[model samples]
Target: MPSRRAVLAGISTGALTSLTGCVSTKRTGATPGTDSNTDWPMFGADRMRSGYAPSAAAPRSSPTERFTASLEGTPIGQPIIADGTVLQSTWYGIEAFDAVSGELLWRFRDEEPGDTAVQYQPPAVHDGVAYVGTESGLVALDVESGDEQWRIETASRVSAPPVAGYDWHHLYIGTIEGELLEVSLEDRASSSPGTVRWKRSVYGEIVRLVAPNIAGVTAGTTGGEVYMVYDGRGLWRTKVPGGVTAMTAEQGNSLYVATFGGGVLKLRTAAHAGRVSWHTEVGPVAQGLLVRAAGAVYGADGGGLTKLGTDGGRERWTFAEAASTIPAAAGDTLYIGGTDSILAYKLSGGTGVAGARIDPQRWQYTHDGGYASGVSIADGAVFAAVGDEPRLLAVE
Candidate 1:
């Protein structure tokens, strides 16, 4: 596999600047979550939430445990990788570690040492900055030193990760009270701290947000409404059966959504008022998001992991005993977190055999507490945060 730097070198600077608003010339202070090709900057790896890492290859055999670092609190969401560092979000604060050695590098607390300021969403790292959402509001920290760059307090708790626009000049964050705020990242250097570009009201509490492309932002709400806003205008709103748990985009034209009750819906972004191409009842979806890769849509629910055909929503395979967290892909292997182990499965033509058991030949890592957080692959290693225990482990 090619290195991240090598993969990034092939991306035209003009294309990079046009897509993200910042030229990929400077690697030192580039936006925290902007290097999707190499780093798992945010959930689903990129703005489209594909959850697929192209440069990193999945481990063919069982990996050897490298190291595990204890955390201050339980990890609430997935950990992101950037510049050889792993960033994790916990109930207490944000923790960073050396990706290769699992050494504690820096810790950023949103509140005082003793006071508890719960942070449920993972931080989005880009351009040397780590943007995290806490109970108070959105806080930006310098990734290198863990210093506070700026913070914006919101009216309610922020449980969802902040999505960076293509230009990295703006950040769109959703609050627990159903409000979406657009923050200006460019004005942080001035005395103003940061500016609120605009604020919009959605139907319910926004649980997930993603910028599929430069055209607009797709937001999923707890009220079962998915809103697409572009250029500060609400383009369309599509209502699903249950509260939206996760969402992803395909080629900027299709939106894949996973609901809490037990369903996955695919909507056309450019259709007349957003048309539902297909909807399939998977099972009771717990907390994992939907991922699109290898020409199929993969989702995890209370029933386990299910692979659905993207063309017609046909059920291809179902793993009813896997982890409830979202699975990550590298090459043809699918890594999933279970209640007590990290297991790998083979994906043949984007589908697994129904009622098929996990092959012992593949990689498997068992721990005291089950793996709950999403797996991040980089530098030929798999990084995961162990649930219940305050630990993050790297296997290679």
Candidate 2:
């Protein structure tokens, strides 16, 4: 395989543009039908942020690269797959591409020539609209044509990804200034976007926001506090030992939170009260998303990737790779993106004992850009953004 830089250097500007144009015609400008069971939508599969694809069957062996497409700007979040299209949020704008052929479909830019609107998080797509957050505000665009449907300005920078309610009738977003805004979907139907259904202020900068299994929103703050809100009122607040780094993942009635202070906490998200069931110190939690699978909760940080038993929060297994991105799982196979390569691991044995370990024989994909933004899997294919220049890599 050629180095990423070599492959990129070999392609001329005209040739790349021509290839992009060829793939553009393959798109029909219609919203592609979606298979909810196989699609990896939202930040971590769903509002719970589980980062687990239950219906996906990831390749058992290391897969070969299918294609790579360059983007306009840096991608700081995971790419979302739906309706045969892959949606990516970059610093400059939001882009859509044909999922199988690596063709550019459409691009949406909300900033002016000299204006700056940094979009570092993934966009949540539901029905036919893609909701994305920018430094200035949130914007909704048509998934098929990349046309702006509505734009709503925020009081401050919108840094995290927006999540849709379970009913798909509401959108939840948090800002850097600690304001959580709930936007009405019915208002968007009436051509009124940004209608504030309700807004609540939390204690510190809100970095990770998720909608739990219960009726309200859960937000983790930079001040190490997790706040649960219903309507416009605070329901419960729990302080972790350290600053919260990522969104919480839910299983049954439990919420799993990763903290920078080197621990993962299991809490109950019922009755407007969050009660910690167990707190297991696992290295420093990564500043990305946390994943739950089988009977374990997986987290990564500067220390490495650690798996803790979901029952009593016991350490199951730890891999010594410095990871800052969330891990994705399909079946018993877990895929993690590290600083330079994508690794494949097998979750062996039953519920207890050491479950996950790196498959030393499995083929690993190496790139010059490094796998910084994480990985996502759908329909037997693995998707990732590699290197600092960031090209979307598809493997199967």
Q: Relative to the true structure, how large is the alpha-carbon lDDT of every model?
A: 0.74, 0.73
Cα distance off (Å), candidate 2, residue 258: 0.8
Which tens-of-lDDT digit does each residue in 1-396 have in candidate 1? 864334444656554445453322211111112222367777778777777765565575778887889987888667888877889888778889988788999987767887755666887778888888888888888888888887888999886788888877678889999878877777555424367766788888899898877756889988999998876689898999999888878785888888887488888886656788888876336375676776677777766777776787787667655778867776656677887778776554221123322232265678777666777766677778887767998787
Worst 10 residues of 2 by lDDT: 24-33
lDDT value, candidate 2, whole model: 0.73
Name model 2 segments beyond 4 Å from true.
Answer: 1-37, 115-117, 187-194, 349-362
Model 2 residue 56 CA deviation (Å) reads 1.0
State TM-scores per candidate: 0.84, 0.84
